[model samples]
Target: MLKIKNLYVSINKNLIIKGLNLKIKKGEIHIIMGPNGSGKSTLSYIIAGKPKYKIEDGEILFNNKIINNLKPDKISKLGIFLSFQNPVEIDGLSMYNFIKSFIKKKNNNNILKNIYKKCEKLNINKKYLSRYFNLGFSGGEKKKNEILQMLILKPKLTILDEIDSGLDIDSLKNILNNIKQYINKKKKKRSLLIITHYTNIINYIKPNFVHIIYDGKIIKSGNKKLIKKIEKYGYNKFIN
Candidate 1:
């Protein structure tokens, strides 16, 4: 569903991603792990078509079309959803208002019902529905809210950046299980790309592939066994 070939990216004339390559097929879940400054987040943003990052070389293809220069909104319209690492708070926009505006469905009642159902599954308080989006929400609550948006949109490719960071054990398990069920239900046309430093998520949703990204490039790629190697030896074993 997504392919990156020798992608070199830079911001403010400073190079970041260098010769990075990755491919994610439909129905597959890929995990990317790396230390700070490894360009993992940059790669995610690049795929989502975030502006200002110059694609110095190579290309990004989505569903057989080159998306290297498409705007973020256009990319999103092409069935890509990016769950931010730090979800921003909209000061005056109520969650209900935001959802109503963002979702393109014509049936308001059906949208509301689906939103409420997902909110209930994510343990989002009914009161939050009327409050400003993400305003004064705890880290976990914000994360859950991101998941809620994902559930409602049902994008073709979901890119979750560090979603497990602030989640507690129960929240993490619950959220991951929901994601697992979503992927299973739409396996033929859905795909997931997760950027995380934690391995606990593996217990809830097993990844089809694990990749170690370092210094702006994917250094190693393998199946679940790679997770064990990363757990035992750390990124040092994969570096250099």
Candidate 2:
């Protein structure tokens, strides 16, 4: 569903992603692992059409169409969803209000019912629905809220950047289950590009492919065996 080829990206004139190439087919779950400053997050932002990063070379294609120049909103409307690693808090916008505005045109009673069902599954408190979006939420709360949005939006390609970071064991399991259910609901029509540092989440998600990235390039790619290798020896051997 998403194809990135020879992608060189930079911010403030400093190159961050150099010759990165990745292909995520429809319904495939892919995980990207790398140490800090390896441009993992940069690649996600570029795919989501964040304007701050300039594409110096290569192309990003979504559904076989070039999306290198599309705006973030356009990219989102085209079925690409990115859950932020650090979700920002809006001071006065209630979570309910934010989601209502976000879903856009699907605010009927049935949709509301579905939203509440998702909230229950994600363990989001009913009271949080009235609070300002992400305002004063714990790290785990923010992560759960991201999953809540994912459930509501139902994007074709979900890019979760460290969704497991602050989650506890129970919350992690709940979120992972929700994700698996969602993917199964659509019969392998949804895809995910999960970027995480630890392998704990993978134990639950069971990604179809695991990639080790270093210096803005994928150094190795494998199946589940790669996850076990990274958990054992770390990324040192993958780095030059």
Candidate 3:
């Protein structure tokens, strides 16, 4: 569903991603694990078309179409969903209206019911729906909010950046379980690209591929076994 060919990206001429190549096929789950300052989040931002970064060279292809210059709104409209690591809190906008704005089709009772059901599953209070988006929400609450948004949108390709970061054990299990159900609800492959540092995530979702990224490049690629190795030996073992 997504392909990056020798991607080189920079911010203010400071290189972040260098020669990074990755391809995530339809109906697959791919996880990227790396240390801090390793360009993991930078790669996710680049794919989602966050405007700050400059693509020095290479291409970002979504479903065979080059999307190197597509705007963030354009990318979202094309069925790409990115769940932010730190969800922004818009104090003036209610969560209900914020979500409504993203709905391309007409909003109706069915949509409202579906949203409420998702909130129930995420343990979100229905009253929060009327409050400002993410405002005064705890870290775990913010993460759950992101998951709720993903469920409502039902995008074709889901890119979750550090989704496991702030969540507690129980909350993490709840959210990941919901995400797995989302991925399996449709017969067609709804691709997933997860960027995380925690190995605990693999305990819930079995990824098709796991990659180790270091120094702005993916240094190794393997399966769940790689995660075990990282747990046993840590990231430095793969640095060479």
lDDT of each: 0.92, 0.90, 0.92
Candidate 3 local lDDT, 152-219, one digit each (tens): 88899999999998789999999999999999988366989999999978899999999999989999
Q: What value of lDDT does candidate 2 attain over all alpha carbons? A: 0.90
Q: Is candidate 1 or candidate 2 better by TM-score?
A: 1
lDDT of 3: 0.92
TM-score of 3: 0.97
Give per-residue CA lDDT, model 1, range 1-240, as digits (tens). 999999999999999999998999999999999999999999989999989799999999999999999999899989999999999999999999888887988798898888888988988888899999999999999999999989988899999999999889999988898888899997889999999999767888889999999989999999978988889999998895
| TM-score of every model versus the real structure | 0.98, 0.97, 0.97
Number of clashes recorded per candidate? 0, 0, 1
> Is candidate 2 or 3 superior in lDDT?
3
